[model samples]
Target: MMDRPVGVIGAGRVGTALGLALVRAGYELVGVNARSEASRQRAADVLPGTPLRDVPTLAKSAGILLLSVTDDAIGSVAAELADGGLLQPGQIVLHVSGACGLAVLAPATEAGAVPLAVHPAMTFPGLPTDADNLAGLAYAVTTRPHDRPLAEELVRDVGGVPVWIADEDRTLYHAALVLGANNLITLLAAAMEALMAAGVPDPGFVLAPLVRASMENALRHGDQALTGPVRRADVGTIEAHLRALRDRAPHLLPAYLDFGLNTARRSRRAALNEAGRLDEVIALLEARSAEARDDIDR
Candidate 1:
């Protein structure tokens, strides 16, 4: 009736971070396995008293094994343990891959272990500390029926809110997260570059609050909070921006147009509840995009 000892495979940032977290959360650190001396050193530095072993050695004895290996390495590692005759029935096998679902752990399942993929929806900046990142984070827990509740409980044990994801939606869900997190950072960097090129005064100083406020307002009101030329669909201003961005950050032109079109679509939806010239506004944007295409073909 007691929880099994937790074993962590792969001494990467996520593995090491979660291992230390589990230690504080009262789970016994059974052991960790990694191929590199640096990896072992990292594990020892952060998680003292934890033994270092290879996959079979860790899987043979540890009741719960956390596979924090890279996605490509995941199947091979699990298969190695299965082929080596090291795994046993009913052991908790967990992997931290976001794109892969429970299927990636088929080797572990073949070895009679119950497989779970618990993906933490947060980035590890490879900093010395990742404990704070674990707090208030959401984890997607996917497992076989017999193993799902245990997976959820284990995620809860580590102070993560567990969300169930359909197997088919795993890739799409991760895609959406990447678009929101990574793409946001990419857009911000591009924005800064463009501002500096424009000779904007204290470009960073000017952009910091403006960008933050736009995001903050969007969070509060969703699409209803949209403003600026796109929301108003000011053909003149948008056309001017298109020209300037093409002259400055030509790479961002497509993104600007795509996101602008999406924003206009949202604004059009918002216009349904209020009295605004959203219809005419969209028509003008359509005209501009068409004209830009025609100019390009010329």
Candidate 2:
């Protein structure tokens, strides 16, 4: 199957990057199907010399079809190909949706195509260099037991390490990734916004080392790495923060309180010695949250 020609549908950031990686890995990219102008441009830029074809043509010409459409569009696209009799028997059909499993490609399976879910656990910024990030990344793959080897090989060809995920566990696996990666970005953005509001210049520069060290410590020590007023159970400091946020960054008050409450709970769980004071901190956060809600109502 490594020698089979590959075709990509919905040549967006991830699709184009993976296609480029496969092409570099010696797979013949027969064609691509990209609907929007931006996607078409991305495919042209990243997978230059690859022919742009329609869905039916791309599906028929390639021995392996990569359905890189949005999570919601995967099933519908697979059904369309199956309905049009575009998928051939023994052909490999895979999607790059972390949230979906082989079930989304049931239509292709019914058409005698092998279905696999191959999701790389990395973000793609749609740049030409996005393919470089694939190396050493973990790919969460879910497929039939018989197709496991094929899925692993495909992932390795794109420079990814295959991590077998159960079909039933795909949603939870993807949820964890979103919670870690996406929510981290949201948290950083909110923190930077608060810094700017406080008249700080070069917020990223100021936070870079601290954020890096905190992430490293958290990854290495888990909850034991937690610090700050929440961990210390400093109710006075927490109150001061709430007042400052309310005065200068009212929009951040709710998030600050919510995260503070969670941090206090985690600290309580981690340190029995701090549990008593942490309970007070939690109560303080909850009360502030309620007050913030009341202010919003007014």
Candidate 3:
């Protein structure tokens, strides 16, 4: 597989980053198929000297074809390549969708091509250092048992550690990533807004150390790291927070209530809080949520 050139079907952020990594790893990027101007420009900028070709041309020329398109578009793209008689026997076809499995590449499989799902469990922000982010990160790989060696080798070639994820578990695995990475951003943005509303000049600077410590603690100790008013059963502090959010950031009230209730439940489960006190916190959050809904209805 290393001897064969690799072709990228979609030159988006993830695609371009992966292509660049492979090139740096000494694999020849034979061609790229980028539809949008932005994607084309990204390919030209990152993968200099690589020809921008059409899908069929890429499929025909390269021995390994990477369909780094969106999760929803993988099947159609694979079908297109298969129907065009472009995917050849023994050719390798792979996708970078964390949510999708080998099913999306069934068309390519039917065309006698090897199908692999290699999802890098890292963000690619399309920066010059995006390729460096691939080093030591996990790649959720799903492929046939017979193709495991090739899949692992390919992941290692791009500086990723291959973690075998069953096809049936791909969606669930991806969901966990979204809940951790994507939702962390949403929660941080909300926190920063609330801090700014409270007259903090530099919300990020104020929260950075605290947030970093909290995350590190959570990662290291899991539920044992639960703290704050919810865990301590500081009902007065909880009520004050609800009142402050309701008065100053009305839109944040619902989320605040939800997170508070979840934190209380986690505390209760971890035995970090007295059962009765945690129940009081839960009740208070539920009541605030009900009141918010009533306001919305009115």
Candidate 4:
């Protein structure tokens, strides 16, 4: 499979990044497909003179077809290609969806194509780091036992660290990735905007290092990594936060509260402002969440 050319059915970010990188990694870009005229145009812009082919055509053209479409579209896209009678025996099909398991490639398998899922655990901000981001980054791989070696080889070929997961639990595994990466971004956006509103000059300068250090600490220590008001259970500060957020950014208030409450519940503490006063912070957060739950049920 490493020696064979590849096909990319969806020329979006992941598709394009992987396709271009594979080309650099010494794999031929045999055939490609992208849904919209806009997307096709975009692909053409990137790989000049590459003709647009249907999904099935893309499948037939390469031994390994990268099903880089969105999660919801993977199954149908695979099915359409399989129905076109394009899959040959011993061929391989793969997808980059974090949550989708081998089942997303069921159609390909039915058509005698081996299915593999290669989900990278890094965010796809843009193309600047696409080729290099997967290098040394953890990638979750789910597939049949027969396909494990091939999948691992492919992961390494593309400069990624491969890890295994069971077929049934892929969805939950994907959820955890979302909670960490996506939620972190959403939380940071809120904090950054808040800093700007509070008239903190050079908000990024003020927040990036602090946030990075906090993340570094948290990753190193797990729940014990918690700090600040929530960890200390500062009821007064929490109350003030509720009032101010409700007044200024109501939409973000719920998200902040929900995450805060969850963090508080996990930390389990209350009533102090000093460093390492997490006991006080945790208590207030837990208490605040409990009060919210009580009101909700009423």
Candidate 5:
């Protein structure tokens, strides 16, 4: 596939970054197709001198097509490209959607394109260094046994290590990634806002070291690194937290109760035994949740 020309079907952040990375890795970028003019300009910026054409034009010109559109659009895009009758046998077509598999590319496969799924386990911001960020990253590669070598080679060409993910587990694997990366961002933003609401002037600066250390420890020690009120089963402290959030940040109460209860549930057996009242914490959370629901119903 590297010997033949490459094209991008979505000029979003991931598409632009992957296109540039492949270009830097010596892949011949023939053309790119994006849904919008702004995305076409982004593609032009990433792959200078490359033409920005329609999907069919790109399909006709390139042997390896990278579909980096949103997950929902991938199937439709594949169907449209296949219906155009531009794909040829032996052509390698891949999508960079973590939540989807080669099934989304069935139309292209029916048109004789060899379908593959390659999802980089990293974020892209449509910048030049976004391509550089691909180095040393892990890519979830899903493909048929005969196409494994092709997938691995493409991953390596862009300085990534390929990890085989079974098609049946793709959605679960992607959900785990979302929980770890995307959900962490949401949690951290909530923490920052909560801190600001509590009068912390620079929440991020104050929280940075603690968050980093906690994450590193959690990664290194698993659940053994659990700490704080939930792990300690400090019912009084947790009750106080619920009260404060209810009075000042009611919008955050549901997430707090849910995550706190989950954390309490996952606390080490030894810690719960030591506290001897973990049930109290669970009860407090459950009662508060029911009360909140009752209030909403009222």
Candidate 6:
């Protein structure tokens, strides 16, 4: 079963990279079904000389079908394959959507295909280096009870560890990843822009060590790694910073207050002695919120 030819239904970043990696792992590459010219070109580059065929053709020629389409398109594509009578018994069908589960492949299953979800828990730039990026990363796998072992094996073959996730937990699991990966990118961009606004010549150079060390510490000690005014409950220092933000960078004030409030709450839960200080900080935040409301009303 592991030696069977695998066909990719989409040719975007995940599809191309995974196809290339599977080829490298000794799995037979069964060509691809790309929807667009760009996708066809990508497949040609990654799995060069692999034949380009239609969805049903690709499904017929391969023992495994990987649906690497967009989230919304996944269900439709499954339905299309099922309608075309392409999914054969004992064949495997998987998608790389973190938020989706085996349910999206109901169409495929009804056609006798074994449904599975195999999401790589990492960002894909769709470049040639994507295969290297896959090494040592985790894969979120959602599948039927009996299919778990095969799913884990497939992930291992792709150079990733499989983390079994319940179908119902897929939403929460994907949300956590987005908050950590996507939102972290947004936060970093904001920090870099704010530093540049403050006359820093190179924000990346200035932030590199500080950001890296903080990340390392947080990974090691969790909330205990927290520092600065929020951790110490220094009301005056926080107030001063809030004032500076309002004057010099008003756009950043809302985010600052929101993070400060969340930090204060976390600190109270982590340390009993800090409750009083945290209460004071919360009061200050509430006051500021009231002032903002009043200003908006005016």
TM-score of each: 0.85, 0.97, 0.98, 0.86, 0.94, 0.94
Any runs in candidate 5 off by more than 4 Å, and if so which? Answer: 268-276
- Predictions: Cα RMSD each: 3.3, 1.1, 1.0, 3.7, 1.7, 1.8
- Where is model 3 more than 4 Å wrong at Cα? none
lDDT of 5 by residue, 1-298 (tens): 5797898988878877888889899999988887688887787677778777787788888989999788999999899988988889989999999999889999999998899998889987677678879989999999989999889989999999999999989999999999898999989998888999999999999999999999999899878888898877778888899889988888888889888877877773546445447777778888888998898899
For residues 1-298, write the lDDT of model 2, one tens digit per residue.
Answer: 6689999999878878888899889999999998999888888889888888998888878989998789999999999999999989999998999999988899999999999998899999888899999989999999999998899899988789999999999999999999889989999999999999989988999999999999999899999888787888877888899889989999998889888888888888878335678888888888888988998999
How well is each residue in 1-298 modelled by candidate 6, as lDDT tens digits? 5677999999878878877888888899877889888888888777788888888788888888988789899999999999998888979998989999888899999999999998888898767778777868888899999998888888888788999999999999999999888988888888888888889989999999998999899889988988888878888999998898888887887778877888788888889336888899888987886776676689
Task: Give the TM-score ranking, best first.
Answer: 3, 2, 5, 6, 4, 1
The alpha-carbon lDDT assigned to residue 207 of candidate 3 equals 91
> Which 10 successive residues of model 2 have the least lDDT summed?
269-278
User: Candidate 2: what lDDT?
Assistant: 0.89
Each model's C-alpha lDDT?
0.79, 0.89, 0.90, 0.78, 0.86, 0.86
Ranking by lDDT: 3, 2, 5, 6, 1, 4
Task: Give the Å error, residue 291, model 5.
Answer: 1.2
Off by over 4 Å in 1: 36-49, 200-204, 269-298
Error of 2 at 206 (Å): 0.6
Write candidate 1's Cα lDDT for 226-261 as tens digits. Answer: 778877657788879988987887766766776777
Q: How close is candidate 5 to the true structure, as a TM-score?
A: 0.94
Who is ahead in lDDT, 2 or 4? Answer: 2
- lDDT string, candidate 4, 82-121, tens digits: 8888889888888988889988788889989889898888
What is the clash count for each candidate, in the order shown? Answer: 0, 0, 0, 12, 0, 0
Local lDDT at 293 for model 1: 74
